[model samples]
Target: MTASWKNINKPSSPTTAVTAAQVANGPVIPPQQRLLTYSPDEWEGFVEEWAYYCLPAKYKYVQRFSGAGDMGIDIAGFADDKRLKGVWDNYQCKHYDHALRPGDVWVEFGKVIWYSYSGEYAAPRHYYFVAPRGAGTSLSRLLANAAKLREELIANWDKHVKDEITGTQAVPLDATLRAYVDAFDFSIFDAKTALQLVDDHRATPVHTARFGGGLPARPASEKPPQEVAATESRYVTQLLGAYGEHTGSIVTHPSALSVPKLKDHFRRQREAFYEAESLRVFARDSVPPGTFESLLDDIHGGVIDTHDANHADGYEKVCAVTKAARDMQITANALITCTNPKDRDGICHQLANEDRLRWTRS
Candidate 1:
């Protein structure tokens, strides 16, 4: 998730250009309906997003395989260090004009069983057939009843699985292979309906951009902890140095500030820093990558001149820079809408933490 919330929180469906028939009928195709028109590569890309982004916490790693000799592994999600040899799952991407049927995937079943039996890789814990049109009614029933699915596959082995496993040679179901097939678990095979895929995809950062749905609501920002966190050390030290410069003494801590007003300001600054930190975490879970960094760049560009201006003390410089940041016109970034004035202030401190901004001419 990135800092920017540009595409999120908008309408779930954007209005597309209407055709003559649609104008006359006053009907618009829904976003998911557009999947049927997608090319093979586009469909695979959608599945890839669903697998990798939507299930990050579930799978240790997700990889997409292409070209020949892949052994029917379109996408594999590893659960542990053992990778394919250990617990894993597979997502098979299929983009056809119609819904997937039993006839469409018997060979795929054979490939998985044969390859795993040959020690090429362990059989997946779960195998999902993901298609644009989803699985047909007949196939859906077979998948639901695992025994029926296995029976059909074994019965249709010669016609669909034997000659279809590879072009170079036919993989005959001999006595040993037949025994292996009988013991294999067909319960792991299933299908994800198109609607389910779309629903799950909503959790990913790319969903809004790909489907035109607005982002989910932003989570509430967390309050700062009572103790100063170690991550705040650099910026806090700089602020204390600025305060020291103003008072002509070493201001070691916030409690050391004699002026009540300065103490309040210090506390407020700490709160603002935590606010920005919360926003950074929000961006990580909600938006695309680099959103928060880009917002920082915008704030840095807006406040640099004011920071460089002459001031009687470093405190004045800090105040002026943060104020300028707050007042800065940020019409370009999508994150501007969700940001508060204090977030702009906190972002300055964040920049300082990275040595990108400074106070007291240091």
Candidate 2:
């Protein structure tokens, strides 16, 4: 009846694992790597969302299953509607001030083995150990050599895993259980390092929400060569509402487009709108078919890097998207309008300009 993982508040930014190059060249380090910065609960939430956003489209649902009776499973990804008792993949999120050592996780493995043996649920096709800082050197080496990992698990069973799996009863690794353990698939046990998590999350919408990786450069926007459509009235209305609230005066309609102050607001609104749209467009154009959320993620972060390392430096990444990459201009433009030229304007402005995010009419 035991469960796994802690739960915490929802996150609000991007996540990146420090690359070997970044370590040598000194790019800004992501916060999740800073010792003890994120609580276990926060890591759990991060993984929960990460799984939800990064799992393949084929996985119809990725849900949190970390509390009591979870049977040592944390995030569960389901391909069918049957939910808990169906075909699924599990992600175990672990947060440690230090990298994961072998002793820290063997018990969790034993539980998985025991639970499956007891018919609590079918063994997952994949069982990932998600650690914020990643596995320790010793563990990493062992994992790289799967045969060694298997040997080590069996070698350490009596000391690190047996008692817990047995609990109050005398359920030792009897021949039946031992055979299962001997034949158990260790390939299912994999580690998701902080860097891998960051890489995987880079394409998800909530990446920025949790890790805060800034988006690419803002793309330059010109007045689209056509007259503003009447459909754009919503943008005009919201800008006027902001102006009214900011300056304590009322100005309505595109007719006000001629007024100097309001006109500036109009231009800015249009620019922001186009930019936001461009980002969403960029997201759609980029990435694989199943990643609508990742597109949102890129737009939200105000930057999207080409998966192929087309741009290496931070400056180049932003500029390339803004000036070089075809059709990704809007992604660049919105990032500039919302996060760069000014700091801390939420997606509301981005959406308002895009016409989908409406503001108070009154």
Candidate 3:
């Protein structure tokens, strides 16, 4: 099951423009109600957004064509280059006010045939009709039988398809075109119900962003582990050398590690070292994973700013510097104990911002 808080912390719905009826009525309609009255163009965009996130990530190039000139396909998906040569599938979005009947599919079927016959694009691997309301029972039974769908299309051709499919020209299905249409793979065509679209949409990442569904951005309580290894040899050497300078170690050889005074200092330093190390882990974990690399890049790009008005005053440059230092210490102290990185910056800034950076000691 999805880890969404459905009741109290339910994800918010996408915002839509208020309808005129809603404005005059003094009570707003639900978003779901707004969807029922979407304009033709709006339904196209809805299907496009749905196809974009729901399609396999490898498609990478999903696009919607502008109206009228798009030769039949409304939404196109390509695996590589952004053209018909690489086009893999197409979604035809229809937002009828009622359930889809077999008669409604006539013009849609004609456009696909005429376009394919004229070599505008090859027959798509999958051709889906995505509508708000799903197929009617009559159409559903007809869709189950490919041969029956063909017969129904040919039966309704002149009345539903002929003049509507071609704007200025009358293009009747000749004997050759009729044979081609019958032989064409009807199984490739499918109807996506509104319920199906809703089901898939509810599981998408966008759904979480649209509605506060995912786990709260709270940081983990347990500190990240600090395991000192050869990778930290430079620090270990500097630390042990600094200890030797303070305590005056005379011991040489590898036995330096066993020197009593040096060992005691090292013992005391362990807690502090790991405590600082935990903060580093906390900062790294604060943002979405892998953003620390971006933070480093931003720093390399010279995006760091030091003049925090709250922390520094310009009475003297020296005074500002000392104030900043004190601010750093306070921020570091709070950051070190932060169990949740999602909490505010004194806790730890998740990302590097030009106005303010959350980390103090780093």
Clashing pairs counted in every model: 8, 23, 3
Over 1-362, each residue of candidate 1 has an lDDT whose tens digit, in order, gives 57777856876664677666455645555557978888988887788778888888889999888878889998888999898999999999899999998899999999999999889999999999999899999999999998888899999999989998877898999999999999999999998877888888877766656764445787777777777789998999999899888889899877789988778888889889888998898777766788778999999999988988998898899999999998989975657768898898899999989888887755
Candidate 3 residue pairs that clash: 11-211, 11-212, 12-211
| Residue ranges of candidate 3 with Cα displaced over 4 Å | 1-34, 208-223, 228-342, 345-362
* Alpha-carbon lDDT of model 3: 0.58
Ranking by TM-score: 1, 3, 2
RMSD of each: 9.1, 16.8, 12.2
> Ten residues in a row with the worst lDDT in model 1?
21-30
Q: What value does the lDDT take at residue 266 in candidate 1?
A: 88
Q: Each candidate: what lDDT?
A: 0.86, 0.62, 0.58
Q: Give a tens-digit lDDT track for model 3, residues 1-362.
A: 66656545757774988765456555654434555788889888777767877776847688898767787889988876745755578888888888788777788888888788777777777788887777788878877888888888888888998888867787788988887887788887888886677566655545433322232243334332344455334444444444444445632222466657556544444443344344456544332344334433332233234423333221122123223333442221223234321222211112222223322221
Runs in model 1 deviating more than 4 A are 1-31
- Tens digits of per-residue lDDT, candidate 2, 51-143, equal 777776858898887656677888888988876567788888888777898889888888898888888888888888888778889887876
Best lDDT goes to which candidate?
1
